[model samples]
Target: MTATVHTLQANRAPSLEPMMALTTSGMNAVNAVILDRMQSKVALIPELAGHLIAGGGKRMRPMLTLASAALFDYPGTRHHKLAAAVEFIHTATLLHDDVVDGSGLRRGRRTANIIWGNPSSVLVGDFLFSRAFELMVEDGSLKVLKILSSASAIIAEGEVDQLTAQRRIDTDEDHYLQIIAAKTAALFAAACRIAPVVAEAGEEAEDALDTYGRNLGIAFQLVDDAIDYSSDSATMGKGVGDDFRDGKMTLPVILAYARGTDGDRDFWRSAISGDRVADEDLARAIDLVRSTGALADTLERARIYARRAVDSLGSFPAGKAKSAMIEAAEFAVARAY
Candidate 1:
């Protein structure tokens, strides 16, 4: 097996296509459920939710649900609805996050909050949460319910924790890691773990998948943080300096600030304190992250987590399912390029 941490040379990076191909039929089913469940008599509910749903977001979490079931060669369609539920939970978070962050762009388009206003965006997010729970209850598995519901709660707590830590120059890497594990990785873990439950593949399998998802989720977020400084909006699908402008204390910022000169530290403090948000300041911030090796180090850290994610699958049988999942982890870190 190829180690998941090799530097992704140009044109040799991993692709999500294999995973997408692996889960095609299942994803089609999941998509139908997503489209069907997002509907409501209230025109705005679907309208607002549909804006983000149709916004070219890669349904990665739900696809993980489908892919993990494939790992067991489970031949049931029950995962379709559950996968849809996972996506609903994810979409709900994105909606609420945009509102909370006052974000203007997502996936290269205006956010729902920007288009429809925060109140509608928030209420629609609440509606999606209701739909996610309804799907879970309809699944009729207490174990699945507990896993997803707990993840949802943890995600909420993580968001609150992030809100509290937002823009604080004193926020450390360990605290940042805890926040991402809950806010981001919790759903990823629940999405994969539920596969074994519906397949009745036992607790050991569940634990393995949980670890895979959690680590992959961390890698994914770390890459996103690095991309904010290194990639353009065309690549990132949002403003290149959005995190900087928002005063987000992502790993790249944390590391750069930690490794900065006295002058650089003062600049970071002012930048993160919202005192220096002009485009030139953003250019300087990007330079500091790169000059301090924070960007490269953050990506290396992502590769570390991605490797763990791939290793967690060692217990599973080897085949396209396992290979695709492994490549998915590679793709998570490779996206930075």
Candidate 2:
């Protein structure tokens, strides 16, 4: 059998602009709700929330919720509030994550935690989480509340699991996957699944969308991990090797540690466990990851999940929304950052 070689450089997936265009109107509503609900007499609440919200993320999660609902031609406006709620859930997580990670930058700007304080960031995250629930209640659907609430709980558990696994070289691929699925993919699944519920699209459609989101979420995180070791700060928004310095047991590190020689393993352990790592150490770490083929393998794994995400949409009818969704999955793995 002929051998096949894969490279991240060769993957040119379509942009997400088309999907955003498809849901532009719905997204407008979502944004409006986000702005409206973020307001408070407290003043600082909106300032802190708006700082992160305006900081130039793609808002991919809420877009997915809106697009999935559009896939079913959902006429109800409840999805607008639901999509805002999804964004609040996502933003809240980011705020809390920065505090947990002691991150200085996000989207190429200082993290909220750094600007305000850890206490402010955590409390604002709590506020957003509570606001998300309020929107869910306004939607008047117990099912929506159940799905998002479950996702929130799973995300917290995943964060704890990752905290425990941090700097532990023994952390395996399965454990890493479990962490990402819970911390990240759970929300993606809920965001997509909720759309069909609001549309009354029945169980089959709901299941299909759920599968799509779950797989896409996994692919997205895989690429994110790979980029942490491969890209520059300008391209990646956050600092390159942030994961390495933080001792995150992401897939690339896991694979490299598992496949490396004894000396290589020692280097990984020392580099990751150190209180502070120099630029040279990060460079050496990236070289080790590249030489072990871990980066390529991680991207290849992400490609598999992206394919699965697209395949999950097979049961849906052909249309603009469906095509955009398929492209969205492809974009998940193929994005540069």
Candidate 3:
């Protein structure tokens, strides 16, 4: 397959049209409702949680929570609880990720760890995680609890693996996929899968949503990795080349190092794996990635996952919910850039 797609967003319109419409929908009372529920329920955490959430999120996970609930024609309002639960889980991970990566910025602002200190950020992340369990238990659903619990464990394992594997050039595409699936895709898969149970659907709807979530999660991470190589601080929110300085081996950089000639191999050894990469060497790394066309190739690979993610949404009937789900998948790849 060719390793370039000029416009992934444009191509995704027909399949993910529903999900894309939501990006234009804007943040509104849905958040107000969620915040009210959160205050009444997890009062103290909401103080910190509100700060983390009250910004420009696409609400993709919460959308999955709602879409799945809507798909089964749910009569009750527990899906609201579940949607908040999704955002809480997502937010907690971001807090923890900043601590782990020592990230100073996220979503175009100072990271929670940077503002609150790693200790507070880590503890707040724990509080939110425990809050999720508290909410899940109130639902009294064993299946929902199980799905989320398993996803959490896998996410931890993926993060541990990533920390251990850093600077290890032997790592390949499969390893990268595995780590992203566990660390990033786990909650997404769980969020979609548990939606049917909240609506009390049978096994089939549950299975389809599970599949959709898994593929979408994988696609999201791939695009995230690609963006680290190509995007700027304004579009990405975080520092450009932040991943490189932190010694992250994202798909584009990984591909470039592997396919490059002997000099390129030496460059990776000296710059990426070395103690401290000078400014000149860092710029060289960017050049090598561009010359190797890995950025375009990685972007193209992300496109494949985007297609798979939206295609998984096809099992459901056509409607606003389905369209939103598809567009959300496309947005994962397109993001701001």
Clashing pairs in 3: 18-323, 18-324, 19-323, 19-324, 19-327, 20-327, 108-237
Report how far residue 196 has shifted in candidate 1, in Å. 0.5
For model 1, where is the 10-residue window of minimal lDDT? 1-10
> What ordering of candidates by lDDT runs from best to worst?
1, 2, 3
What does candidate 1's lDDT look like per residue over 1-337, in tens digits?
3323333347766989889999998898899999999999999999999999999989999999999999999999989999999999999999999999999999989999999999999899999999999999998999999999999999999999999998899999999999999999999999999999999999999999999999999999999989999746677788789889999999999999999999999999999989999989999999999999999999999999999999899877677888889989999987788
Candidate 2 lDDT tens digits, 1-337: 1222222234454779779999988888899999999999998899999999999999999999988988898988999999999999999999999999999999999999999999999999999999999999999999889999999999999999999999888899999999999999999999999999999999998999999999999999999999999846666789899999999999999999989999988888887686548898898889988999999999999999998988888777777788788888878876854
Model 2: residues with Cα > 4 Å off, grouped in runs: 1-13
Top candidate when judged by TM-score against the true structure: 1
Per-model TM against the reference: 0.96, 0.95, 0.86
Best candidate according to lDDT: 1
Q: Residue 163's C-alpha lDDT in candidate 3? A: 86
Show where candidate 1 strays beyond 4 Å. Answer: 1-11
Model 2: worst 10 consecutive residues (lDDT sum): 1-10
For candidate 2, list the clashing residue pairs, or say none: none
